[model samples]
Target: MWYYVIPALVIFGVVHVYTKSWLYILLRTWRRDLKALIRFSKVNYYLLKWERRNMTVPKVFVDVAAKHPHKVAFYFEDDIWSFQRVDEYSNRVANFFLSEGYQQGDCVALLLESRPEYVCLWLGLSKIGVKAALINTNLTGDSLVHSIEVASSKALIFGSDFERTLKDIQSKIVHLNKYQFNENMSLSKTLFDNAKDLRVCLKESPIDAVTEHIQKGNLKDHILYIYTSGTTGLPKAAVITNVRYMVMAVGLNKMVNVQDNDCIYDSLPLYHTAGGILGTGQALLCGATIAIRKKFSASNFWKDCVRYRCTIAQYIGETCRYLLATDDNNLVKHSVRAMFGNGLKAQIWKPFAEKFGIKEIYEFYGATESNSNLVNIDSTVGAVGFVPFYAKFLYPVSLVQCDEVTGEPLRDSNGRYTICRQNEPGVLIGKISALRAVNQFTGYADKVATEKKILRNVFSEGDMYFNTGDILMYDDFGYFYFKDRTGDTFRWKGENVSTSEIEAVISDIANLSDAVVYGVEVPGAEGKAGMAAIVDQTRSLDLEQFAEGLRKHLPVYAQPIFIRLVDSVELTGTFKLIKRDLVVEGFNIHVVKDEIFFYDVRTKRFVPLTKELYDLIMQGKVRL
Candidate 1:
């Protein structure tokens, strides 16, 4: 028997080495060498650099404004605006800034929602080398002020709809104007009295002469100053150059297969990177039409897709999932064949394709500050994509050096920057310098706070890397997956706990819209206890069934000890889950309005959250 087992083991090893088969063969094609297989491979869509001839974004609008002047550039409800109209309005708004003494290096802030006016102001500032710093209007007080100062915007253009939020921070701006549209609903002579009539202003001799003399901006200069959708800490303003936008356009058009006849349904916020910097920029650059909505609506999504003949759509996490959760039969009838953007988790990736008949999804990884990007050209599940060769695109991943008691890198005799082994989750970083620019973090209120994020001597002496502060793991083949955030991940009973990994398991439960997993500090305990906050509270929880589900999927330390029921999870402007308030409100019995309960691993059931149980858990008297 021993002699036969030895021969069988050798045969198994040979078989495993020869076969690297996949359920989806095309998804693995990205691993092929671009230099050798690019020409023959259908999956290899783009080269490292797009074009030597610098293509600026304003050139896109200017070309369309000339070629398709009379054709509709945008549509809403029954209203239509032609490329000529967009150019005309944007021109006057441009003149408005110039006449007010705004110049080449000045900062202009955009605090409006998605509208034709947003584009008007965007192009307006681009005309004179003035950069537009788009700020999220949902943010308030200190957050609002922080964004304004970060961009150093001397002038602000705001939508009158948010008169109060604008008014709250009015005293801070250098110069401010509340822009109101004189649309069909309010076209009265009285309504036109106060607001500037852009059409009337353009017809005047002064603005018309200026249109004849259009100034071009340097392709290398920064045109956009946008920020990270700060969920954990203060957001960082990112400087986006014309060259990067041009690179994005080439990459996006190829990845999503955008064409002249296609219409894209976009409701994602323009202030963020996806909508304005990537989506709208690419649409205009590709000569494709866009049907811009005020905001994302789960109920209205399918209907909008159908009504607009939208061939392509952009989505983020929870957006696609919520639309799928609606169980709408009309999903199949819509024209959304290709979906692009990021964060399509593994659970819904397959079902979304099957249920909606989606032919393609370009799930690529890009940030406002990242020089590297990976596009899912071959429909790879759970991959961020590939970075160009110049930077080697090696995501600086973190490796736990030793036990939690020590804070140092575990080193080999080689004395190199020790990182996680392949497929092992760790903190992710990107090399930042004059090249492979990662200029997103612009220091917090304190300059010292800003310097803390910069990691030096990364792989070699004197080399610097920008800390991503995100936990990620990479495969042998260059594909990357997000594990969790550094602060969000915790140590639990001698094991490192990935909060996102645990949430991914628990989120499968019925009626859970979203779930956030974190750790709670317990006295006398060596590590923290895991906790979960599920969004839906209307349906009573079946402890027996849930515990069985979790036990089957997650490891012992990964299983949540406490279950919190929330009506809805509070989110940042970017739709990222907010955990700060939850952590601050911590499971205080008297303060919490929502029902709190604990899972007893010993009993394998959930018990009522009592004062006695809470006290015992806090003192580490109760064993998890």
Candidate 2:
């Protein structure tokens, strides 16, 4: 009987491995996807919970604290703060603000790096019904002044690291009360001391006052004034309501199925949406611990992850690229199961996932102020987000044909905007209205800037939509792929060329660490000529091979005409490429100290842009 039982078990195992039985396959998939379905259900539950009760983020934090008081909310460096501890810290911060004559509805500028104190202050300000303008700590001079002034911030709570930056622009800011985060040897020493003293004196603020603010506050009421990265120009103050924060917090956590024991590595700055709200908020929403870092360090990325036993990590494309570029073994070391963020390039997505041993890449698409959000739940490489067939009717996201020259949406004879056909690149827009709960674009602090984003009388009379300013295309499978920004696409040789496409080709060809692709005006060229600023760390680029590869991958018009090799690529604090200076410099060898190369159409190879060739090109003697 024992011999017969062993033989039967062996036969069953063999058949299970080799055969594709319908019942077996069905059970396998159900078992695999059961957890994901439960996570989705949790997301719906949270959304419904928030809708039923008009709960603010601070109120939610308090509720969570009451439920799990001893749960570690945040882990910074070597220190850990529980939910109750953070709540108490925030209460002190609220009392400190109140003690300094601050009141409800007043704006407070927060110029700080990533730290536990930053979170405390943010929650504290929210508790007191104060709008916190999370100013980029990297900003200084006119840019810094404009950001604070735009939010009408009366007081500034900055990290000690930014004392030098604050001192530089001290005279420019008006009606500003400054309080340094830690070590106040410079400005606001008194405020710093008072805040600390108040923390001990007043362990908690009046909860009823906070409750009243929450009761009066609707989803539209501004709680956060987060400024856009403003890579192209001055940063614009974007209003973020308590409801939006809640949505970001709960939506991201549930989508990722973050567990209470899960630890997330967050090295992104607290001023930006990805780090400050979306990333940090997820930790607060779930009873999870976030290992907060001062800034992203490629060398320290995995070391911190392994040390903290992080199961999740956040990223921007540049950060991922930076980590990949490093020679450190830290890239492969760690327990990171998932990564969530936007700006992940199509080419880098799979390699990053494979190399890092990441199980899930939850790429989402949405701008700072835009209401349209698409999350790629399925690991569709290069696709930022997907709208499943079942949910297509529910979501109002659309892509409209855009004019090549003006970069605006094209309308038909009946004044209806034309929708892009399948796989056709077009500007993405989301329908916005008071009636729609999800697709609401509250716009920026500047009314003019906000008004510029709205398209009226599109598709039908009186119809309105929020222009995402992003050119994207959707496949037959309903997976959306970002092509390029409307402003980034340029026309050349009677054909429109996407800089992102060119960059992708360049990345495949040269394996560049960093590349900034942009169109520059050639002296006599009819359209903007393509140029790429590249940082080749190896300093051993094969010019002929690169030229041949570009010719093979891209059309003649789309190929970059000029390439400038730089020591380092300039990027904004948020890791966005800084192209203004590059555009101004163009390919002038004298202006840009970097070695510049021009594509020789006749030779079908790249040659150094000598003075003779430069003059010939500028004088229209040479055809591009």
TM-score of each: 0.68, 0.72
Candidate 2, residues 1-624, lDDT tens digits: the string is: 788999898888678656744444445445334554566567667766776786778777777888889888888888898888888787777766877788778999987778887888878887778889988665555557888998888887766666566666666764577665553333434323323322333444543335554456555568888876321335678878876776677777887677888888999888878888877886666667888998788888989999889999998776887677678444556789999987777777887787888899988888768777777776778888765434545568899999753357988888889988779999899988765445667777888878888999987889789988878898755678987666656655434466765666678789877788888877645557899988876669999999877765555667889999987876656233367578779988678888899998888988999989898988878868
Q: For this target, which candidate reaches the highest lDDT against the unseen true structure? A: 2
| Candidate 1: segments with Cα more than 4 A from true spot | 1-55, 67-72, 171-216, 229-233, 330-332, 386-416, 433-453, 488-624
Per-residue lDDT, model 2, residue 48, is 65
Q: What's model 2's lDDT at 462?
A: 91
The worst-scoring run of ten residues by lDDT in candidate 2 lies at 191-200
User: Where is model 2 more than 4 Å wrong at Cα?
Assistant: 1-44, 183-216, 229-233, 328-332, 488-624
C-alpha-based local distance difference test score of model 2: 0.75
